[model samples]
Target: MTQQEPAPWDPALAPADADRRLHAPAAARNRDAILSVLRSVLPPAGTVLEIASGSGEHAIHFASALPDLTFRPSDPAPEALASIAGWTTQAGATNVLPPLRLDATDSAWPGTLPPGETPAAILCINMIHIAPWAATEGLLRGAGALLPTGAPLILYGPFRRPGRPLEPGNAAFDASLRERDPAFGLRDLGEVTALAAAAGFGTPEVIEMPANNLTVVFGKQAGR
Candidate 1:
């Protein structure tokens, strides 16, 4: 018999409340820092599509902070979708829509968006290194097809940068990730940028984020 794939990370901590809300420790620690960068980059008003929205904590927090923008959070996991719905109901955030069950590797991603809602920007946090490389390729391909010119595709995670040594913490994290799944590990920033460029994105702006992570933003070019 084939061995079952290990669940991603540890089980999330849940509260005593009857709601399906689940908490990811990292989400609480990094939400504010990520929000600070988002405030400057996201458009003033419109929908934002978030891929692999694990635990749904970020979606509620960001929606609460940026009331003008509508947030559509999606994940492939059923538990994550339940958690997102639970958080949305608990927070009473009108700007956040019901979470979609989306898979990054799907070629028909545009069809998954809610009717009459074209995202002004796409945000993916802490996804790349934890999944297979095909997921990243599919994400770029889908974002390229869905976003209009000058729209942004923002990615947040730990990356291996050229000519710079990995911090001790990130190094250990990378090792742990690889140990979890051979396909999982830190991706090189240069390769990621190149992949985005090929998908019709312009040169990315890399920002230094707390906890040795980085936020990379790529703008869709005028012409494909």
Candidate 2:
């Protein structure tokens, strides 16, 4: 997927109490493509907790499409949470829960789960490369702790692979991200896979996506 400049939500950007809907220009373009991969990997009837859910547009669209699955979208920013709620409300998405404040780097993930609700899948899109390396580690560790065997932890992003030439767009995107924050940039796929294996996830099924993005599907290992 194409990278958007990372900015943690600012409540001042919009009014929380208003019936306004925050829009991400890219969400509409990518949601359908991402949903196709999700449809193949996600469980039929269980909660899907999406990390760093920007704009909440994807959450609403996915929830509407997969009525059998409950969608819980979370972000670290207050404005993002409000936007998520607004979108859910506007869409009348019964399958979506109120957005939770979640920081991917924090060990205490999910902080407040819906009562008696455990995630059947964890969906993270366009987050890792925009955040610190610690966040990716935290995501894997948290998924190891929270997911049961056979449950998938799905990640979508652009990554660098060995012996493969980086796309010009992605190369520039990586440089721009690093210029924004030294800690954030495109990560090596090998390192990510090794980390996931160490975190008790089996080998990932890498699917090519539009815009040089990849949908990496990894399942929780039993009794790790």
Candidate 3:
């Protein structure tokens, strides 16, 4: 069988340890900022399903800080799953569950969760822009199926906003992403919002973050 190449954005740094914990430099830089928004948006108590949880650093940090809420981190890569498990053990974070092997493009995602553990929120950080558009579509569809009315689906990433020129850094980053994979590049915010709306979500609340990133929150509509 032919081996598939790892994603260009996959974490490449790791500490010298047997537990297989990988490190992403960006995760450490952005976790606290992401957590700040999560504090006010997340449900007080319930599971928060995180998709494409790259290095597991964000999961460990968030789980440690938000002990009231359980975090379920998942990724499609075997290395990523190992890294998440390693970080969970290293941090001794009881709130963070073992990582699941989940692909954002999979239609069977609703069945991938642990029994009776419906998530109160779904979070995807720095994923859509690095993944195929189908992943974004599938993510919305899965979140729509799983979350209860009024639950939030939060996404954090660089996006192209209508009328606003892309920030220089983000513009360069977008180019690099597309150079690596033509299907991957910053998505237009208006398009993502429209897709969410079609999937039974309300208009999103867009919050600006450091490094030209955004935290966009869409709530599941009632009676959908």
Query: What residue pairs clash in candidate 3, if any at all?
Result: none
Note the residue pairs that clash in candidate 1: none
For each of the candidates, the C-alpha root-mean-square deviation to the true structure, in angstroms, is 5.4, 2.8, 5.5
Estimated TM-score for each candidate: 0.92, 0.91, 0.94
Q: What is each predicted model's overall lDDT from 0 to 1?
A: 0.87, 0.85, 0.88
lDDT of 3 at 141: 93
- Kindly indicate the candidate among 1 and 3 with the higher TM-score: 3
Alpha-carbon runs more than 4 Å astray in model 3: 1-9, 13-17
Q: For candidate 2, lDDT tens digit of each residue in 108-149?
A: 775566567789999998889988999999988888878889
> What lDDT is obtained when candidate 2 is compared to the true structure?
0.85
Give the C-alpha lDDT of model 3. Answer: 0.88
lDDT by residue (tens digit), candidate 3, 121-223:
9999889999999999999999999999999999998889999988777788888889989999999999999999988999999998877788999999998
For this target, which candidate reaches the highest TM-score against the unseen true structure? Answer: 3
Clashes of 3: 0
Off by over 4 Å in 2: 1-20
User: In candidate 2, residue 67 scores what lDDT?
Assistant: 97
Clashes of each: 0, 0, 0
